[model samples]
Target chain A: MTSVLEIRNLHVSVADKPILKGVNLLVKQGEVHALMGPNGTGKSTLAYTLMGHPLYVVTGGQVIFKGVDLLELAPDERSRLGLFLAFQYPVAIPGVSVANFLRTALNARRRAANPADKGIPIPEFRKLLKAKMDMLQVSHDFAGRYLNDGFSGGEKKRAEILQMATLDPEIAVLDETDSGLDIDALRIVAEGVNKLAGPNMGALVITHYQRILNYIKPNVVHIMLGGQIVESGEADLALHLEERGYDWVREKYQEKAEA
Target chain B: MSEQVAELEKLSEYKYGFSDNVHYAYQSQRGLNAGVVRTLSGMKGEPQWMLDFRLKALDIFNKKPMPTWGGKISLDLDEITYYTRPSEKTESSWDDVPADIKNTFDKLGIPEAERKFLAGVGAQYESEMVYHSVQKHLEELGVIFLSSDDGLRQYPELFREHFGKVVPPTDNKFAACNSAVWSGGSFVYVPKGVHVEMPLQAYFRLNAEGTGQFERTLIIVDEGAQVHYVEGCTAPTYSRDSFHSGVIEIIVKKGARCRYTTIQNWSTNVYNLVTQRAVVHEGATMEWVDANLGSQLTMKYPSCYLVGEGAHGEILSMAFAGPGQHQDTGGKVVHGAPNTTSKITSKSISRAGGRTSYRGLLKVYKGATGSKSSVVCDALLIDDKSRSDTYPVIEIDENEVTIGHEASVSKVGEEQLFYLMSRGIPKDQAEGLVVAGFIEPLVKELPMEYAVELNRLVQLQMEGSVG
Candidate 1:
């Protein structure tokens, strides 16, 4: 199967300080990849770099998405290229409602996908939004509220997933969505991700714990240390890291460095 | 004045710059004088006392010096024509108006907006109201909606009692000028215990060149009554500066409520200086929703006097200043009686080297015990070149009063823009969303039509200013 996204030797810096020092990864359709490491290991930096944040300067990198060079695109252009990032902390836009935001995103994506396609009509958009909200178990009233404004931790996560479901991006990067969510919220988010994951969608689930992997099993698990991936294994590797902690990974990396 | 007009002529992109080709039946000489005031009074056939009031106001206007505070203004009094009448008399039907004048109001969306959801409608062209109408159902409910001139001719006793009570002639220089040369505005009166369910609207258009429009509006909501009045102002762009100095006074009597909403969008070469105030009596409420979007220099502070126990006042003001604009606007509250309350929320946006300032005052008199007041001012500067300022004066002599003031100035956060763009929205649209969000509290308080129009204007202003 052709890979949906490929990141090769990606180096990024913020404020002139290098954070992601040559990271490599690949995501293919119909599969879930987990990138896990301790705090301050630059996992979030990788997510931001992939999403084209201006603050995260890409020093040396090549990001290829569906045969196009993603590094040369703007954030909104990358989003139209079917790339999605569920932010660790979603920003609150006080007056833009969830429905309006989703509709705008959907239209932008549609225009990029097909030049001649008109935007979805309001009634049709409402119907599709209703279906997505119902599938994600999001309250109907949530769509009328401002996007992420005054939303609780769980509500923010659910709203993100709801957006992902509406946009139907080809590849999605979930950046620490389980950080502040409780078990119930974690299950709901994982379920939403699972329902949308198939031959049509690919996901890179970035997290710090193996707790969420229990709900959404990953095809491959990668252990990142200091800015680069140090190890890759099957799903059981996540459980092993949970039991021995990041120290075990650090020791393994240290042996390799010394050699 | 000719030099400024020559300068403004260099920028020809003003959409509403075209003037109609029509004859003015009664155009006064191009200046403010006692004879001009007398001629206006004579033309309206006013009583001797009314003429005396105008003459006294003219004396006050001459004695008082120009205001020195707020934004810098270079208006030459000698260059402004105080009055001009586009038609001989007010018409009750739009078809009866002169075709040229009718076409002007037609382009401004007067009758269409009136037919939408207005309980009463009034259209003013230049110095005089050309058309006035009220729905039959509302007229049957003992509601009196008429032009100020008609109010004086029809209900002289009522007009004489409360015409200049709230904003007197000597209140300020602009107030005195407006009192001296005022010509066209609305006079609305809701009887005791009757509520006007729909909004009464008036549209004022300035189509004459080198002229001044002084509209005097007075609204009285009697005991246990309720009313809402909304007015919109627009002016055709003239190379020479046009002036708009209006006096809006409202009286919310015991247990009554009144809301006054204004949306002012003049041409860039206009100076809009005005005084608007209200008096809230016992158990009454008064709300002022003012939005200023255009003009070269505007200094307006709508105030309220809480004259009875348990009175309440609310002011929601929004200002957007584009290039070559300075909007100095805020609200004032005077708690003159016991247990009165007031709240003021001001939001302003400045971009493209424009400046906005919030100047407000809150006063609690010596015997106004147990009163509470709060003021919140938030300003957003879209770029480094733009500026925003806040000046709040709070005076409290009553020890038992509670007063709070909060002010914040912010630049558009880069992170916020990135977050929005990551969702597939373009950069210009992203910036527009952020601005609309910033002023959401104030815009949401406006009527539906005005809120939509404000959002559209905000979007248009954000097109080229986004990073």
Candidate 2:
């Protein structure tokens, strides 16, 4: 089966500082890949680089999604091509209401997909948005407020998942969506992801804790240290890392790298 | 009278020079002076009191040198055409207004707007008001809606008491000039406890070449009255620099709530210098929503004097300066009474070598306790050549007051641009979106049509900007 995404010998930098060195990653369709990395490692940098964040420059490497080279494309083009990324620390944009923003994004996506698409009619669009909000357990009032302005941590996380459900990107890069979420919020956000997941969708969930993985139950767990993944296994790897901590893995990776 | 040599020269630069051919018995010859002032007053058949006021203002206008404290005004008094009346006289009905002048307002979408939404409408064409009227109920409610000149004529006692009282004639050169040569503006008096459900609107257009619009608008919201008045202006772009030195004064009597909004998109060749001030009495609230789009150089700072305890004032301003334009605008708030409050938020976007400045002042009097003021000014520079500056002065004499101010100038961050573009917005559109979002507070204050036009003007400024 063709992989949903292919990253070959990825070398990236954050603010001129060398971070991800020769990192190779791949995720198959219908699968969830968990990335567990230590603090100060290149976890978020890798995720941002994949999304083509200008701050994270790709010095050397190629990111191929389906058949297209992702590095050559812009973020919105990638987004239109069914790529959505929920940031670890999402940006808060004041004055842009969630309803208007979602409408613009969804309409832009629909227009790109169907040449003659008129975009969603207002009544139908509101109805569809209402049904999705019901599934996510979010209030209808959230739509009218400024996009993520003055929202609490748990609310922001749920809002991110709400966007993910709305956009329905093909390959989503969840950059620590679990961060700052309480247990209830974690389960709710995870439930949103599970409900949206399907055969055509692939997800790369980057996290530091085993708590979120308990709900999503990833197909594969990759442990990252010193900017590159050195070990890969089933979901059990997360439980082991959670129990033993990242220090043991770090020490063993250093020993093996030296050898 | 000092000659308007600059005004005549600028009017001479107006290339279209399209005269719709309206015959008039009298008009000011090409520029301003005591002769022009006397001619204008006599043309209106004014009483001696008004004539004396105009003469006093004319003397002060000549004596008061141009403001040197702030922006470069450089207005050549010689070039300004003091008066350019498009119609023979002001009219009281839409049908009575002349066709040539009617066509101008028709193209600008005023009559249709009045029929659809406004409670009343005032249209000023060149130097005089062409039409002024209100819905029947408002007129029956004792709301006196008339032209400023007519107001002075009809209710001289009322006009004399409040006129230039809030923003005195001695305030500045432009105010004195507006006081002396003031022609047509709105005269609104909301009676006590009456809340105007619909917004009253005034449309000021400078269609004539090389002219100065010295419209003096006076609004007095009596005790506990609530009113929202919106004003908008536009001019055909010309090569010669015209002048707009208008004065707007609002007196929110004790316990009244008044909101004065202005969306100004004058032509590029107009040098806009306006003096707008409001005095809020006990428990009164005043708000100013200002948006500036077109001008060669604009120096306008809408201010509020909180003279009564528990009074409050707010100003939200948005400015977009493109090539060959300088938007030197901001706000001022004076907390004169105990427990008074004020808030000022200014947003500016400069592109294509355009310049924008936030020149503001916030003051708390010596004995005003528990006064609070906050000023936030943010500027977004689209490219390298554009410039944004902040000059804020905050004086707090009371130790119990809470005053905070923040100002920052930021070029569009590459990360923000990339994040937006990665979402599929093109580079130029992305920059425009950031700017639109940056000034969203002010944009949200505009009416729908004006908001759309503001966005389009910002987009135009963004054209060929992103490399």
| Each model's fraction of native contacts | 0.68, 0.44
**What are the Cα lDDT values of the candidates?**
0.82, 0.76
The TM-score obtained for chain B by all candidates, in the order given, is 0.85, 0.84
Scored against the native two-chain complex, candidate 2 gets a DockQ of 0.41
When summed lDDT is taken over every stretch of 10 residues in candidate 2 chain A, the lowest stretch is A250-259
User: Which regions in candidate 2 have their CA more than 4 angstroms from the true location?
Assistant: A1-3, A111-119, A247-252, A255-259, B1-27, B88-133, B204-212, B233-241, B397-400, B408-412, B444-467
Tens digits of per-residue lDDT, candidate 1, B90-205, equal 21233322333334344445455342111111233333333223446567889888778888899999999999999999999889999988887878889999999878766422
Interface RMSD of each: 1.2, 2.1
DockQ, all models: 0.73, 0.41
Error of 1 at B59 (Å): 1.2
Error of 2 at B3 (Å): 16
TM-score: model 1 vs. ground truth:
0.90
Per-prediction tally of clashes: 0, 18
